[model samples]
Target: MNKAYVTFRDQKSRDRALAVLDEFRWRKSTLTSKIAEAAPDPIVKAPEMPVTLSFDPDDKTPVNEKVVKSTTPLYNVTYEEQLEQKKKAAYSVMRKLGNEMAKTNPELQQFVRFHKLRRKGQICEVDDIKASPEDVC
Candidate 1:
């Protein structure tokens, strides 16, 4: 088995990698629950507002204003709820991907484990294991 360490030259790459890992973890844990929670609720059309206009003869100007109003759906979730739902979805995807990777490249399994360890500062070196030609699924 080969160990792989997570490294990025820039903060953006590091952040992106970390986010991907987090999403993967979430995907593995609560995929079904997240999907069920995110299912679309009953759709309702928003109420339209009336438009009013006024004309000023002195300046020969027409002023128009629209009163726009919106109502939240009964099943609408809060921002925090939405974020949690997203995190769950991400975890599900990550879990699936990890499983696929394990099947295709058994060596990569160790790399992922090492990466996780490195992330926690529990590991210092990650061996770069090359996959066998037959294992390259």
Candidate 2:
């Protein structure tokens, strides 16, 4: 390991980092640190505050009901209820996504007919042409 420059969100954090670095001991060697001598041309900017993620009861957006139910306290839920919720969630996801995907991608809809024939043993496998890589070096 060589040297590293660490940036902190606040001066307190930077001070703590410097203190830790100053007396840092690794293996049988002790490490030393020093403050930067010059200020940067454009001083480093602190990172933005993280997005607040508190849920609002008034929000109308669709939510995964199963997720909220499953994450509840264990004592309030049963094994059978959890299993049923999982099955419903899985089924709804697959049904919705599959339909939307088929509607958006024409090629998927084209393959649907072939898939039906394949399931009925009306389609046969064909060998794909394999191309050998050409060395251009």
Candidate 3:
């Protein structure tokens, strides 16, 4: 049994294809087809305009063997966003620490108890860690 799904940019093309394919005799067998309703949201979206870049071997640009690239973020982030990202990462690390401390150290249980209680703020909480008191509140 052969099965396939198709999508066209317009409804006219879809209708035409379905009309041509539906109940048509092919290789001594009849074909079954219908206009399938597509979901409101596409499974994956194609970029409006795609750019495909490839390395050029023929173009001679002298490759420097001892060149060091700059260690910079690809996307620009505001100070508040950066701080929030760091806080989320710190919370993840703290949760892992809490799990290990709970199992490994009974001596630190009394100290860890306070942290565990306050975990409602630390665990899974994403907030700007370096914001002013007024801005944070």
Candidate with best TM-score = 3
Task: Identify the superior model by TM-score, candidate 1 or candidate 3.
Answer: 3
TM-score of each: 0.30, 0.29, 0.33
Off by over 4 Å in 3: 1-70, 106-114, 121-128, 131-137
| Residues 1-137, model 2: lDDT tens digits | 57777777998988888888896898887888777666754434333445576778897755666466556644466666665666556555545555566688777865644653663321224233333456756
Q: Identify the leading candidate in terms of lDDT.
A: 3
Which consecutive 10 residues in model 1 have the weakest lDDT in total? 30-39
Which candidate would rank higher by lDDT, 1 or 2?
A: 2
Quantify all predictions' global Cα lDDT against the true fold.
0.50, 0.61, 0.70
Clashing pairs in 2: none
Q: How does model 1 fare in lDDT?
A: 0.50
**For candidate 1, lDDT tens digit of each residue in 1-137?**
22335556987876666666543535346211111124444443223445576645686333332122123332357666665666556556655666677678898878766654654422233233333465566
